[model samples]
Target: MGNFATLQPGGRPLVRFYLAFMLWFVGRAIQAAALVDPNVRKEFNDLPDDFSFSLGAAFNGPQMAIGKDSNGKVKYLGKNSNIVPQVKITIKSMEALFLLFTFRESTPVANSRERMTVEGNLSHACACVRILDIVQVYLLPKPIAKLAIKRYPKWSLKKHTINRLLINLRAIIGF
Candidate 1:
């Protein structure tokens, strides 16, 4: 009792334990929120379904030939020289939208295993739509572009992410 202020031998260990427990609890809570938020799920479901394109096809456009000149100077190429195929995805219902969103979020494109699963799901879902096509595209990173190109001969340089929901307001009703 006389030296209680300076005799807390186990106080530091207890404090550390409490902090660790709190952090773990908070992390788990955040993960749970990400998994169950209705708004997040709805946002994910609003992605398109009928659209499809390939990166390799984009590279095949004439733009690739318009590089720097022999003197190492950039050159401007004509507008018609580059032609990229446009993909238009159409969603018939809310259920289809949800399915697409789940597949995209769960399977990250960079991971081989995840990519395979996502591609499989996309293919399956595309079959349900009258005019949907699932096109395979290779991911190209800037730093490892050469290595990627060497590894996958047909890979393209363009990369894209599904960041927005392209919903046809006219087609969709209250949900």
Candidate 2:
């Protein structure tokens, strides 16, 4: 209902907990998406194998890093801020970020709502959004995904089934 950043009840412990949980949840989805999506791998292929990106709420909200391995498979880098991310998606508040994670808002929609901004290379931001879209395909059903993305792709049935199985398998097994 309101910005969690402004609330700060109990010194913001709830906000921190929510941010931490979302970071892990979204990080897993990103890893699964990157493992199976050709385009995601293609996007990272041009970058170094150790390349990483981040998404978080601005003003000290939770942030998580998504890094690529030598094979371009995405890995979760934990909540540590030791390694600087090459690109960062900064949502203006925890409320906005929660909306995005819940699929009530998409990246483009959030940007239009002035709830999020991207800092660093613009192309990387675009690439990261694409990666998020791939994650949505695996995580959300068609009707719900329609709400989360500007465009819900119309892939063939065979392709969808195969991709879904592979993505879900890796995501569940943590491989």
Top TM-score hit = 2
Per-candidate TM-scores read 0.18, 0.83
Q: What would you estimate as the lDDT of candidate 2?
A: 0.78
Q: What are the root-mean-square deviations of the candidates from the true structure over C-alphas?
A: 23.0, 4.9
RMSD from true fold, candidate 2:
4.9
Off by over 4 Å in 1: 1-11, 39-175
The global C-alpha lDDT for each of the candidates, from Candidate 1 onward, is 0.25, 0.78
Name the lDDT value of residue 121 in candidate 1: 40
Candidate 1 on 35-138: residue-level lDDT in tens?
33333223223423322221111211111111123333222222233423122123332222222333332212222332221222454333212111111111
**For candidate 1, which ten residues in a row score worst on lDDT?**
130-139
